[model samples]
Target: MQDAIYAPHWNRNAHSVICVLRGRAQVQVVDDFGQTVFDDELQQEQILTVPQNFAVVKRASNEGFEWVDFKTNDRAQISPLAGRTSALRAIPADVLANAFQLRQEDVSELKVNMERQGNTLLRPSRSSSQWRAIA
Candidate 1:
């Protein structure tokens, strides 16, 4: 799990309360302005609440991360901010370029790279370049 990441995502209609079962993870919650709402290292037994539509991401520690979460909606729906099942993949490269002020090639590179990577639980390499800065 050292290379594992929960990926950046947001619940459409549910709020989640998560409790770490073991290991440690750096949890980050961001606002619409791309500002950090909460950024903390969660250890065993620690808990956090992610509000509905609020983006969240988790990076595992060397020992890996384990957690359990409950959502307000029984059939929770999630929209990942990165990876194949993300809006980034659905967006046209030209639109991405215009929105982020990036070159078309750069946007294509970002999207293509992420499309090859699955959504939800991802195990990105240490050297992998993340395009989270753009969106």
Candidate 2:
């Protein structure tokens, strides 16, 4: 596991089994309707199965975490909900702005931030605080 939270994402072609090897983790999986499907803390030697295409996020405990993930497909395509790999970036700015109910300028600013961060496994520091708030 990584120290930073792995932002919600899904693998189009794979299901995954994660075995905790060290420390602990908080795992959450959600359905298409954004309903929580699973939420729990996993400690060393525990395992969790993530069904194919289910949106999931994993956050390491304060002591940090490590896990071995086995995926059904060797070549899984991950679509992130935030950050550089987010599928939202592929949408037209005007369409995205309308869908998100945000001003075009705000959408542009979001795009700029996304581009600047590049592909990161973890959400940025600013967003991480929001996660903590929810936790």
Candidate 3:
């Protein structure tokens, strides 16, 4: 959908080969070290391959976004990082605070914000048109 944002997630057991079928999108993939591995704008007919456990997020253009995500497995299990049903929701606030060196209340507030954004795919906010790629 137009302006929609796919939440950051990584497959637990499969690699994904994504082919953009319609519109355009801003895609960002992150490595384990929290460094961005790939970040660029994908236009119609473009394709992107994301390895297992490599977090990926996408924001749709105003024209809307559509794609076919081919996974290695018949049913790929995904773990979302931003959402109400995300892994962050399962961890104790104190644990998260300790791990991030943040206050427990701050961690709690962060979780609340995630919930407010809606689970998984988020609603449209702003349209992005700039194009940049980082290796």
Candidate 4:
């Protein structure tokens, strides 16, 4: 299997937990409608939890990134209680672009990087509207 990389964003109604499987990841979980809550770099096999809404996670560029996401919903098989939560939110392109340390040239390079490492698991060209609903 290959690693997955993505931009992170926050949502008020969703909560998610990410567990690293192989490589490194960067995460920022914030509950504030206007402030930074938590920020750090997570190495291999680390686990992070987002209790409230508005959290962001981005896979580091220099390291291979692989992780599993456990999304939550009230009607799902594993529902979260009052203090628990679940859901996935789309990270805006502008916000995502800001978090990464790359120029326009890197976009093509990112694909090259993935292709060389056999990590092209996500089809970024597809419309977000057609993607599966994860929560």
Q: Which residue pairs in candidate 4 have backbone atoms (N, alpha carbon, C) closer than 3 angstroms, thus clashing?
A: 72-86
Best by TM-score: 1
The runs of at least 3 residues in candidate 2 whose Cα sits more than 4 Å from the true structure, single-residue gaps closed, are 1-3, 90-110, 123-135
Tens-digit lDDT string for candidate 2 (88-116):
76788999889989899988877776776
Q: Which ranges of candidate 3 are over 4 A from the true structure?
A: 91-110, 113-118, 125-135
TM-score, model 4 to reference? 0.47
The digit string of per-residue lDDT tens for model 4 on 1-135 reads 212335344434546677887767566665556466777888778887776455464645355677776666543232211111321113333443566654645434443443344221232224532211111
Which ten contiguous residues of candidate 2 have the minimum total lDDT?
126-135
Better of 2 and 4 by lDDT: 2
Candidates in order have lDDT scores of: 0.83, 0.77, 0.82, 0.48
lDDT for 36 (candidate 2): 93
After aligning candidate 4 to the native by TM-score, how far in Å is the CA of 68 from where it should be? 0.7
What ranking of all candidate models by lDDT puts the best one first?
1, 3, 2, 4
What TM-score against the true fold does each predicted structure earn?
0.78, 0.73, 0.73, 0.47
Best by lDDT: 1
> Once all C-alphas are superposed, what RMSD does model 3 give against the true structure?
6.6
In model 1, state the lDDT of residue 116: 73
Question: What tens-digit string does per-residue lDDT give for candidate 3 at 66-129?
Answer: 9999999998998888776688878888889999898877787778776665466666334443
